[model samples]
Target: MAASDNTPATSGLHQQAVDLLHALTGRADAHFHPGQFEAIEALVENSRRALVVQRTGWGKSAVYFIASLLLRARGRGPTLIVSPLLALMRDQVAAASRAGVCAASISSANATEWSQVLGQLDRDEVDVLLISPERLNNARFREEQLPQLVNRMGLLVVDEAHCISDWGHDFRPDYRRIKDLIRQLPPTVPVLATTATANQRVVHDVQEQLGVGLVESGREPVMTLRGPLARASLRLGVLRLPSNTVRLAWLLEHLGSLEGSGIVYALTISAAEDTAHALREAGYNVEAYTGRTDPADRERLESALKDNQVKALVATSALGMGFDKPDLGFVVHMGAPSSPVAYYQQVGRAGRATERADVLLLPGMEDREIWEYFATASMPTEAKARAVLRELGEAQAPLSVGALEARVDIKRSPLNMLLRVLAVEGAVEQVQGGWQVTGAAWHYDAPRYQRIHQARINEQNAMLDYENKSTCRMQMLVEQLDDPQAAPCGRCDNCAGAWYPTHVSQQAAENATATLKRVGVEIDPRAQWPVGLQRLGVPLKGTIAPGERAAAGRAVARLTDLGWGNRLREIFHTDAQGAPVDQPVDQELGRACVEVLAQWAHDGWSGAGRPAGIVSMPSVHRPQLVQSLAMGLAGAGRLPYLGELALAPGHPGGAGGNGAYQLASVWQKFQITPQLQTALDNMNGAPVLLVDDLVDSRWSLTVAARELRLAGAAAVLPFVLASRG
Candidate 1:
């Protein structure tokens, strides 16, 4: 076990590692796995620049470490390891140190120490360097210092090589830029890249992007692990929530039922806090983590989780980015993730050692909104970002924020933001001296754009397929990933009979039919009858009768407030004292109107045809209308969930506006909280009954009713709000 123990100095591929370990640590035998030896031999036999891919628990790190050791042993040069995660780099350095290797890392956590370490490397006192791509990308740091450092590097190893490819599950533009940095290196210096998982596309991209010949050893044609090992160590579970509050209640219950070190990934910081509170109320140990938490406190919480002092952690994605826990028992997704890859990675964190672990998905309707939001959300144009990067390449040295802003023709704030993102992508490096553009092989051109765009289209098409899927959920999963050969997974919702093909197919068809009916507007049951009304008009809810026309008209009136109508009173109705007044609209109608309004709000009121009054709208129009209407009311302080709303100017019926209105009063006629009651108490105007086109779930309507009654409104009434029969 001594450093001088007999581990024979090997020849050929492993010679560099033996020499480096012997010289740096005086260790004759640093245990190396056979897989590592195979990878090193492949790299030596093939090309200097190569890629090594394997599973996470496998010793992928040892492959490059041994190579670096070998090169240093031969007096080649210092080895540089560019890592994606700072924490992982720290762990590597710690492990190397424990092995008596003079290794150090450069990351945000140890900036000052990095400078000292780099100085030591310059003095020829250090052998190995571990650093994050962000640190290496810093132009000021690179120009003033890194060039000298890299010039001495015997090898440049890109850990997490999958990041180099945009097609990889987690793509960083900075990672795409590393090839240019390598081009600046000495021709004789070798480059080794390693990753845990890379599909064929990823492997191809990594090679092309890095401009290096590949050494693909251990690329098994058949999966080596079959049977029980093929099954995920983490068991995936799903829970359906009736409402947001119910989601909190359920989380609390589950936490109380299952006690151990775990994580609850919630959608929002607020949700995390509320859920943590509920869990604590239920008498369980819990703490919530969010972006707002202080860095020191965050570290403390992580440490506590590691120590098993904290029973559970309720947090957003912000909490777990770089942190790794090998013994984690579970990672509960309290809400649906925006994408499957994100879900997969988060769940993968648990069961690291093939120990049994639980991965839970607490599904809720709110998640549908989250998914829809992602589907429609706008992203920065790839061209715009790429063009900014191109300009960076022209610079002789690192450019300052002010200078880069002018060159990029973007505001300083946005330019800096993009620079950070690009830094993360490994496309550019910022040092104390200036900005340096990297990744020359991955150019911003038409062909690249076409590829990226095609990928986007593929993703969109896949989304549509997922929504329209009629097969088993597991089958759908395999289909989405194009892994048709995947043996039938018997643990998924489909295989477990939680989601049956027949049931889902019927549900999807019914859902589609309802959507069509809502958008088309059929007012009577007869209209819904077979061939009764050819091409149903604006979506009908149940049976719209002549008597409900007034309610419908009343609901339509608020549309203008939601920016749905023009030439209609923007401020409809006044208080009893004859002052200009705006009362809380009914929740159902208000929600529908707000959603429609948001659409027009984006289109500048022209997209909706600049209507002066009620216009036939689709059922899809109703949900967005409600959200917009709610936002407007909330902004005006007229739709308080807790506090009263201030009446519009020149309002009557009260001394300083009617008592503040509760949001509940506007619908159900009850005040749920002081904050909401305060809002309800403030509105001085006559109560406007906001009727919705449909109350499919009736949950929103119920909340609306409670708020309306709590505000002490004169009267609160429901209109034509019906769930799908």
Candidate 2:
């Protein structure tokens, strides 16, 4: 537009913005927070870059929506917001609609509506458009749509802007693309970045990236407005529960007595589901919200909680960040999060628009273990990154993740993250089919990754200190976030005294114990070989012939389950040398094994009649553990124990990787032993029970069962102690 158009607004323009705010909020009493007006003014009037770091309920959305309306009214183009999550976009869309803003999202979830949304954008019908940072990596979106949008865009907003910084608690490699997006935008276009949880380091990092580097983009210096990170309405407390059983019992005892609709955060998806199940059985209206939840069901669940139709949603961190429910009465953490910053963000969800709300942390003993798993999962390994690079470098055509997995040895989540990082570094490009090497020069920044990793460790230790604090928890949290105005709230448990009941009913504890003691989750068989395995030289593709596939398997428990997960995790814990050294299955676990078999039979997932024989998959790390479990089951069930499947010289086990690579790693490693073949031949086609210690990828079970069936076993019913997701 013109220089005059980007100048400060007149009184009439400011009044029109105020009127638009009222129309958007539908409340005559609606007023801006301390810096909200300044943020809006900077974006709408001066076309300036601004960073607003306020608390969760500080009306950051209002600032953007109002600014978008004012800009659009002045004949500027629509606002384009780069949001971090789908939940945030959904809430923002609804909030925008409330203000008469014709907002729409072009996201992975709304592919069918993209053309319509694009048409709306072209016709100047859309006032706001929300999209994920990952969308910028889309070939078509980056090449076509984004360039046009950037040319006419009135304002740029980056929600959860802290994610752009590697120093941030939730540093997403995808958000790094925002820097490129910001660089591509018109120099005169207004820009706003907002986040609830960013320390000084993160703030400066984000600001530098936002200013298009420390050199300032030849534009006005970015305006930073960071407020105190404190929530007066939330009463924080850390309750050190003795065990998971005690924690569940405490919830059973105290949840109903707590205030309005709220959320219960669990560290893992299974924990959330199990806690939700336990709470439901205790007659509390609750539901589970996790990455595993279906998109439509998640919407329903979120709506149900928001409308107060459900008491709470037992959720992982997936339910956090842009979910808006004003009077949410309480926020409880089933286990302490890895960082205080993350905890603050979660507890901030409660008491957003209330005088007082309860926020408790029912800290568990298993918290550290769970923390370690996630911490390791997020960091990219040099070996794995180079493996991905080497594989991509050799591929003749663009390959999807599944195809990449066949060639590379990395898990799906980490692999996806690495691809994004590589894309940002110009080492790779995401295309229509999948990803391709861009043939761009790339260097491994070991020092940078190490620095970030060390920062995370420091954060983790700080969180542990927060859990152990005798002083004000709220004060500690704020200081950790680097809030200059940090102060004790006099509302937390440490500030006042224990306001929560410490007593748990004996019956509640018994019921919790009973529920937790229950085990045996069905493990679904892999019906088809992973795609592109043939390219990986495994020579396998398409459906596993029905006859060759293992029968639907059974496990004592998932390694992530709320029940046997704790023990199984400890048993399978990796050593200081960074390799797993397994422990033998004891008699106590033997009893649990019996229970699993009984439950399996009771459920009839396993065919009628006990297994005629037993075969165990040889373990690279835990032979004794696998042997003992198989032998215990064999003796208990009174079935003949066949020999274990022998490794055909070079099977390295599944190790850790995606399905196709895992399959390739184990495909040629196992063979039916002569002794087992003779045992199977003698059984005259009677079903045999195959046992293993861990079921990570299920490739071992599939391959082992295939060998057994080839040796004439009628059916191979695979069993494992733990199923790792």
Candidate 3:
């Protein structure tokens, strides 16, 4: 059906949709946005698949909710919406209730309500049901509930449809399953996919996926209704401060002046938490939202921001996508995201229902380094994929992730991601017990992965260009998103003048510096040995012996810390020759280490008293740095300096492996040198501080501490310059 097909029947449907929209928004005069009514008409009247690419506040929800109510009044079943975020689902469910559409959602956060939701669905009392894409692979749901839901689905809605394409910035492997679900849907079911972000490539890919099995069935191709992506309400600008402290100081001086409560996005969780702490210390009502935040706390934080109970929520990407706040007044970025498209999507969250909102980016020098780390992390390696496949093929039964971790070198998070990719490629299947090979031959898509990796690099460079671009910032973003309506908005700092304050008070700068300089990150000791270590020839299982455990330790700062992180990153940074640089601890860092030690002493150790001596871990990469830090601390404290631990002969010194393999590689790798033993004997059972340049897995510290404890030391307290959290 053509968008221009507005017959008398379509007109009547439009009138009803407008009425439903009014009810949804609590406005008697509410009307559909430019493309909303057409998309709704295509879905409701023609039962055609449609993809609506509109701006954030374009009433995509209104289109779907109104269509669902219309379908239900015509005796169609409940709409099945595969929403990406819990925040999105909550908002949709509440909105559905307001529109008098009975909606229920089944998500991991609401497992207790599953039975109730299922009952409602069975009783045909639910007009719309929302769920996460991951739920589609749940064994019980896939086998029992999903089939029934598919059979009776009045309409299929894929929220955040860009995730269906790998070209999308925020693609999820589980979203690939949506294509199969769409293929399985009945021919009569109208499908609607909605998103506010997607480049031309991503849009085409999504179109192909959404059109699965429909073309062969003689149904119309998916109709795409894309509107202009530019937002007239956002005044965008880039503010380049010299250091993290100064940038934070700017926020301290100016955050309150923003129109309303908004978000400050950081690239890393540590940055977000650190910024939130600084703001709170300065008496700002703020909270941190990150991937590590508890689900309940996340809900509370979202509500707090929505109700304007808090001034702002300092967050990482965890707060992006589908978080709705119509009157959000400002959006500040502590660091630029890698892609212009992603940046646009996040900033679009602001100025949605307001006349004007400020969007500022404080580009960090460390942003590229952080971007490279994530880019590499998200890409799957052929060697690791093959290793996973070989292990599963040889296994007698399905293997749980833990068991697979024991056999493969990949870490847990990356391993889970690789498995999802494999499952999507049809090489593996997740079952009740665990994951199993499906006997399907799989080829590593080297070219495709390479293209994606290069695409990320290009995007990162494009982001840099965005920061430096003197033309319209919004136009650059829309063009990057392939929005044809891209043009100078005449409102950004480039088009107009900088609308934000750039001044930072001396007092605020001092406070920010103090916040950054504050040190001591606690390192939790490994309480229990990693499971299945016995399979790797290590006889460790269950709880580690208390006598062998190191006391909870401390690091001067995390490698990702917004303050000292840059300084420490320089210390551990690799040289041009691609080898780790070894250097002595600078006076500044040494003083910081002393500060950490002083705080630890004041706080009191958990299982030991003040250190009587310092012993350094043998570092293959940074021996000089490790020795310098330990000896310097020993001298400053006027304590005996115990010699460093010796590496066992033929010990393999390397990194990058899972817990079991990491433990195996370092098992018995550290030996108590004769010099260290002599120093320990003189300490008379006093606690010794074990120093290392960096701590990644903590397995090395655990093993070295065990050696020290067995060698007559009463306790070992681990300390490091930085932690790789």
Candidate 4:
């Protein structure tokens, strides 16, 4: 990612003292030192698009804000500030408003107020407009009237520009079309882009994406921010737990002891709810924040957090982005978060103004598995021009996300996100009722997609490989971004030996093996279970009835051309020497199934050993049963059903192990999230398996198996590792 030659600069603009002061005091400009000011000054005077690779503490905001106001004062019309966080828009608008700059931000906070702002903009009553990309795609805003208003606008300032790059730590597809929007803007309006973090490639992408002018300030802000730069004074605590309940208990105890404003980051809505409930039961005022939260309740929670009415906030990543509460004493991660960007932003929620904050990563095996799950499951696609065009073609009117979700069968959130991308690409026209096709063809272009996709993959791979590097982690990141630092960052986990190289290797190996690797066990989709089905020879068509017998068996019959049976026999068979077969599972389906098995061992293992009970499963989804078995083996270091199964005398483990090795008949249940799916793949392609939800004689397993198979899984096995019935 590189900056374009067309970026706008405020080389000779005379900034009003009021605007300059406002920009200076804003949080974006907070904690600026003298040398950083010199860098900012240079960027202000430069006309070319500049790369200000300043560290975290250095007021990176001043570089863009000052430039924006100065450019405006110099008669550059209105500056359209593209911010990453909706919350930040308020802060920016508030600061600008204080400076006598007519500023308005379009966000979920003021959804109805947008029309008023638009009316004002039409009348030329506003100067700087701040908004989130989400806001930009609002059907009401993207209508013909709004695009006309935008055409009347002047400059474009992209804050947190790193989001535009797939290679960036925080990748948001909504930010993809920012470059196009700028290109569509009044041609003379210059683009000013700013971000707290960006590697060389990310910088390149930002420039290319936004069409920014070239200006490079060779300074690091994170390194220049005050004294012990890493906020080393903050007590970094790692609490390892075996279960969510235990983690909740620890959090409750700490919240009681701390008795101060804090944040607890949860991996899911359920976790947040459970944790909040537990905290409330323990007599603490708390609330959880997620996309699912009602707007009013969400507002109340933010207000509570700000006013310190709530002692703690149990939230997801939604709590990040522009949340500026300076008195937080602790930030607790109730679950593991993927990537440093997410971790930094969430932890950075606390410790505003460089205070002594306690940053705790309370990670359990499940939590870690979930984080790993999201990272591995995320599949980055190329910029598909046709997908964009198809969206634009089908859209007749402006469509909101709700409408889009109704049109498509996908979940509302991701579907809305994809719509956002299409909107940004100018492929679809945003309208009041539904989207209108703008007559642009966004067909898939492999070459163009490859460029962006490959760059992103390279960047992530660099970070993944960083754990194995002998150099400091911080240094490795900096150098990967082409910022070659001679000295190691003494404050990071690497410097303190908190992140041991050995640990990284172990984790990577486990992750790789548990993933959909060729070397792992393949799930056979054709392997049918005889328990709940009418007959073994009959293909399951309609549904299974009640009171069926026999056990769940996964079928690999689909890959007849691939000879999946041979691969399975090779995998299950022992050599003449009585050892497990040595031949590698070569077929795709076999490999995929094996990978699922591996995922179960890594991610699904509960560490409680095999659950005790008569494990029963629906006959259809037998692969899930294997997953439970593998997980039990990994967690408890042995099979739980050893003494329970009535098997042949010479059954593989039956010769020596007790009947407990065989799982008692219990139906297995499942729910899949992209995050959970990633964990399953990481655990060896074992999908998320729940044992309690399964009832005797049900079609759920059958449905689950069909869905998994549809999702490219070689098989879906549902075996009971335990039974409560």
On lDDT, the candidate that comes out on top is 3
Q: How high is the CA lDDT of each candidate model?
A: 0.52, 0.86, 0.91, 0.50
- By summed lDDT, the worst window of 10 consecutive residues in model 1 runs over 655-664
**TM-score, structure 3 vs. true:** 0.97
Give the alpha carbon lDDT tens digit for every residue of 1-725 in model 2.
00122334457766776677678778665555667777887887788889999998888888899899888888999999999889899999988898899999999999999999999988999999999988988999989899899899999999999889888878888888888888887776888999999989999998888888436556678899988789888888888888888889999889998899999999998899889989899899999999999999988999999999999999999998788898999999998899889888888888888899999988888888888888888888888888888988888888888778777878788889899999988899998888999888888899998998888788889988888878799999989889999987898888899989999999999989887888877878789888877776787788898778778888888877877888888888788998878667888889999988878878774663457989998777788899988899999989889888888875455464778777777777888777877888899988889999888778888888888878887888988888876
Clash count of each predicted structure = 101, 1, 0, 96
Which residue ranges in model 3 land beyond 4 Å of their true spot? 1-10
TM-score of each model, paired residue for residue: 0.57, 0.95, 0.97, 0.58
Worst 10 residues of 4 by lDDT: 655-664
Indicate the TM-score of model 2: 0.95
Residue-level lDDT tens digits of model 4 in 1-725: 11224333333332242236445574333333444444344434443334455444345555556655666656665667778776677656666665457888777778788789878877777778887876566666566545875666555667777788877767787788675575465434455566556666677777676542222333221112211123333445454554444455556555655536888888766457656766676678888787778866876788788888888888878777667666677787875564544555566666655446666676644443454445543432443334434544566556554434323333333455556666666666566566666766565455765665565455445534453455654455445545544257565454664521112233333432222122222221222333212221223433232222112432332211111222333344456887544332234533344444455546443332222222222223244434344445334433222111112233232111111111111112233446434433444433223221122222334545444444333333344221111
Candidate 3: deviation at residue 689, Å? 0.6
Q: What lDDT does candidate 3 reach at residue 47?
A: 93
The lDDT, on a scale of 0 to 1, for candidate 3 is 0.91
Candidates, ranked, lDDT = 3, 2, 1, 4
lDDT value, residue 92 of candidate 3: 89
TM-score of predicted model 1?
0.57
Model 1 misplaced stretches (Cα beyond 4 Å): 1-34, 43-47, 213-232, 256-259, 319-321, 368-378, 382-725
